[model samples]
Target: MMLDRSITNTLWQLQDANSRQVLALVQKFELPEIVARILVTRGINVENASDFLYPLIKSLLPDPFSLLDMDKAVDRIILAITNNEKIAIFGDYDVDGATSAALIHRYLKEIGINSTIYIPDRIDEGYGLNTAALLKLKKQEVGLCISVDCGTIAYQPIDDAKSFGLDIIVVDHHISMESLPNAVAVINPNRFDENFPYNNLAAVGVSFLLIVAFNKILREKGFFISKKEPNLFDLLDLVALGTVCDVMQITGLNRALVSQGLKVMSARKNVGLRILFDNLRILEKPSVAHLGFSIGPCINAGGRVGEASLGARLLSTCNEEEAYQIALKLINFNNARKVLENEALSEALLQVEQSVTLNTKFIMVSGNWHQGIIGIIASRLKEQSHLPTIVISLNNGIGKASCRSVPGIDIGAAVLSAKFMDLIIEGGGHSMAAGFSIKDHKIRDLHDFFAERFADFVKEKMIKVDGIITVKSVNLSLWNQLRRLEPFGVGHPEPRFIIQGVRIINPEIIGTNHIKCLITDGNTTARAIAFRSVNTKLSSAIMQSGVKTILGRISVNYWNGREFVQFVIEDLMT
Candidate 1:
């Protein structure tokens, strides 16, 4: 039977789980009923439940050489290290790219090699390898250039680097075409010719594998016989930061990487990361949420509004003073980015309110927006409207756009298709996100193309509930039991449960948009918060004085020295 829609204009569906399987999970693993149900719904059976709940790197880490051209890339990097060649790392301008570059650079530095880290300007250089940047590196006498987090599709630039007497190795994780770029080595799991078991790694994850292979070969060749080898484990903090920030699926190897990486982050081993944490006033133990929301955005702020290379420099630096200065600068840049983001988001929301209609299938808004901030604007709009959104920033007659897509939609493929049809000047991305350039005159055509492409897509938003519970059941014990499913992201999501027959008490606005209130079942009350719900129907329903059912994830909120269970509201039933 179909359930009625919630106040958010979407149906709330309870996830289905087999009763027999749930019982087996509970009996075999000694798990709680709700946790077992969650595991069952995620297709976790007795055979794989152990591995899923307790993912270890030793068990999940694949042979680094399993990726195609891994040996070739390792050999080239070893040659560069042995011959004392000047190496330059060209990376993208996001958190993933910065961490990839920093990871490789730190590994190289530990091996007594100093390499230049180059992050292309988002506005000036756009993304990936450019001919001018390669020529500039060549002029600086850089013999080997490793392009991290990008360069999978830079056919012309890689070829140009070859002609210019600079050998380039591409360490990336973006989807590849049937034909490959002419780099010295193209090490990517997603290569069509490759048979890598796990291909959904972020670019930083790919870079880590490259270093692993490189380290293995060096050890076999007795290169580290006298000198101490770099401890690769120390680098997991960067891996975790990149993996979470890139929004990679936290399963299998990624789950292990982040699980271990959080431990490393807590130790404050990385000087830059430690200073960043201190400057940001993050006193609590680090979690995936802290990495993705707090640290990642600050690192990304440099690429968006300030110097593109600041994040890489901060991550790679060892000098305490340098790290401190860079951390402060990134924080300031992030603050500035927030101001710009708020302004752009406000403008975009106004456009949506004025122009968007119920028939609108795709939302595309263009303005004199900051080029670096459009991606964030698109993300905010997508969350609000539940539609694939494209936010474009206009400069002269050219338009630079960033796209964010909903589930079941392939925005990247759509952008690529648009590019193939000459609707865009240049574009490519993964399924959920993409970017492209187009002429201002073709804006209407691009909109029409996306509209037609997504015409059959359902516009209604849905929230899947794990199970139903009462307000009395919201407690620390339940939250701790749910902690077994930690490090949630794309594949493994934080569980959302429905709390029935709740009434709001002491509802007040907190922060800018969040509502802080106490939800009660007339007997027991629990603290609840609805984040970014202001001005929405959800907020309206949350403030009303009536019996209501709410869906939210349970979490622990610490204030001062007291810890209390907090319900994070997602949707409300009225």
Candidate 2:
């Protein structure tokens, strides 16, 4: 049975899991009933249950040559390494790009090759390979240049580079067009002509495969006999960081990479990551959450407000002192970014309340906002309004827009369509997010275009409850069983359960927007926190007295050298 729409405007319904299948899983795997139920709901059968629970890199890693043009990319990179040609890595300014650039740089450094890492400034160079930047790299005598996390559709700049006698290799994961760039190799899984099994890989994942293939070729050629071979496993930490930050689907090969990378991260082998963790007082072992929330933001802050190349430099640097200094800068930049983001979000929220109508399928707000923080603002607005949101920063008659979308709506494809229709300048992204540029005069046209395009869009807000449990069930054993589904993100979300017959006790505002309180189900009481619910209907319902029901994910909160199970409240029923 589905419950009525909750205070958060979402219908709560228990997910369908076959009881017999759940029981079979519990019997065969000796798993907790709750764990088995979750596995069954997620489409895990007895045959693939073991692999789902324990994703190993060696077993899950795909053949490198499976990707189209991987052989060409590997061969070109190997030729540069053998000839000792000067190489330059042009990467995007975001965390994925930074991690991808660093992974390649570290691998090259291990093989006694020093390559220059170039991350375009967000303000100066918009995105991808610019003709000027390519010319600059060419003037620097960089014989081989590799672009990561971007350059899938950089036809002009790539053509320009090719004309100037610069050999370019595009190692990216963005959706590609019909015609390929004029590069040595465009090794992307999402190529229209490619038939790679798994295509949801982050750019860093593609870069890792390139190196894996390159290393294998080197070993076969006896190049590694004279020098110690670089352990590619040591680079999984970067891959994990990029994968989580990019919000890629954590399944199949990605699951294995992240599951193993988290282990490598715990070892603190990367000097820069080690120092950053020390500075942040991250004493506990790193998890997917830590990478996404704590480390990813700091790394991305450099591209947002500080130096664009700081993240790559920090991840690739070998000096401890330099790492410490860069980590401090990143932390400070992140703090500054938060302030700017909050300010912009407040402004955007006000605009939404004042101007948005129920008929509006999506929210588009333009202002003199910081281009760096508009993406965050778009995400915040999307979360609050539950619609596709576009936050644009206007500068000199041009608007730079960052879009975040809800489920069932492909904002990236819409943006690309708008680009094709000449409503915007240039834009491309995945399903859930995208970015584009539009002339100020054409903002209205773009809005009308999106409105007509999404005229049939209807957001049916529904919250899937994994299971129903009492407050008494929130304990260490259940939490431990849930840990088996670690590293959840994007496609594989953390399970949320409905806790019925509960009372809210001592609801108080914590930090800025978080509601901290205690929940009691008659005999047992537990701590619960609702994040970013201030002045909202959910917070209002949570503050009221008497019996209540909440839908939330169970998590362990560590404080004062102790761990406590906490209910991270997501929604509440009246």
Candidate 3:
């Protein structure tokens, strides 16, 4: 039976079946009904629930050879490893790119291969493989160049590298074109001609597969008989960080990778990561939230506003002092990025509010905003309006735009179409997000094109609530039980529940813009906080209501070494 409820006037959607099988799961698995309902909603059954709760990397891992061109890619790398060729790693300047490059570089270093890392400047060189950089690598005597988190669509640059007598290998997971690059090998599950099962894997995830295949071949060759083998488990920390930072769905192999990676992170083998955790005062074992919000932001700060290579360097460094210095630098960079992001976001919001084309289904804003901060601002605008948002920052006679889309919308495809039609200079991205560049004169055309594309798109706003329960039933044990479904991200979102018939008392403002209140059922009182809800409709409604239905998550909160359960309110229906 589906429990119907509404919060903030948005319909509550439960993305799973409501049937007797939920009770059957509760009885068979000895689970709380709420937990069983969540599992049932996700289609977790008796056969896979055990594996789902305790996913093992070894079991979840697919054969490396399952990906297309895996053999050729491994053969080329093995040749480089044996011949001692100078290899160069060309990576994008984001967290996924940095971690992907670092994962390969670190793996190579372990197997006695030294490789140089190159990241293109976001502003000057733009994204993906560049001819100038490839030529520079060729002149430097680098025999092979490998592109990570990029190069799936870089046709001309790979051709240029081949002409320069430099062989290229592409290990990426981006959306690929029909014709593969002219590189030595292109190992991407998303390639048009390929049908790899794990297309959702992040770039770092793909890089990890290369390392696995390389290690297997080397072990078969008895290379490790003469020397101690590098423990690949230690590298899970990097894989976990990259996977979460890229915002991939935490399911299947990704869940196993991040689950084990979190354990590796707790070991603190990566000096740079440890230093970052320490400086950030993260005393507890890091969670998915810490990785996404705290550590990932710091690592990405370098690529966003500082040196593009700094992030990879920080992640790859082994020196403790150097790690500390880089960590501090990243902290400062993150601070600077926050300031720029705030300014750009404010401007973008104003532009959207005052736009003449405000009647369009998608929000489009263009201004003299900071180029680096437009992506984050576009995401914020999308959340605020529940519509696709495009934020363009004009520089000189050209404009660069970043787009974020809601569900049931394909902003990236629209941008790609615009690019193909000559309405934009260049753009390609996945369904949820994308970026592109256009001439200043084409801004109006781009807006009109997107408006037309989204004209038939119906906007929706819904909150998903997993279950309805009494606040008194929440406890630390229950929180710990729910955590079995750990490393939650895009696909496996953290569960939210509804606690109905709670009286709101002593509503007060807390740090920044959060609302703190005491929610009571007249038997037990539980604390609840609505983050960033100040001066909003949610806050105004909460202030005026005496008794309300609280829609949120139940979590065990540790305050001053005391542990207790509290309601983490998401929304309220009065």
Misplaced by over 4 Å in model 2 are: none
Please identify which of the two predictions, 2 or 3, would achieve the higher lDDT against the true structure.
Answer: 2
Predict model 2's lDDT versus the native. Answer: 0.90
Off by over 4 Å in 3: 1-9, 14-20, 356-359, 556-564
The per-residue C-alpha lDDT of model 1 at residue 482 equals 95
lDDT per model, in order?
0.90, 0.90, 0.85
- Write down the TM-score for model 3: 0.95
List, residue by residue over 400-478, the lDDT tens digit for candidate 3: 8888888899776788688779898777777777888899998988878887888888765777778777878666777
Model 2 per-residue lDDT tens digits across residues 190-211: 8879999878999999999999
Lowest summed lDDT across 10 adjacent residues in model 1 is found at 1-10
Error of 2 at 393 (Å): 0.5
Tens-place lDDT digits, model 1, residues 1-574: 2357888788887889999999999999999999999999889999999888888888888999988888888888888877888999999999999999999999988988899999999999998899999999999999999999888878999999999899999998876766889999998887769889888788999999889988998899998999999989899999999999988889889999998888889999999999999898888889999898899999999999999999999999999999999999999999999999999999998888898888888889999988889989998999888999999999999999999999889887798789779999877777788889999999999988998999999887877778989898889999999998887887898998898888999999989999999999989998999999999999999888899988989988877867899999989887
Q: Which candidate tops TM-score?
A: 2
Tell me the lDDT of candidate 1.
0.90
Q: What is the TM-score of each candidate against the true structure?
A: 0.97, 0.98, 0.95
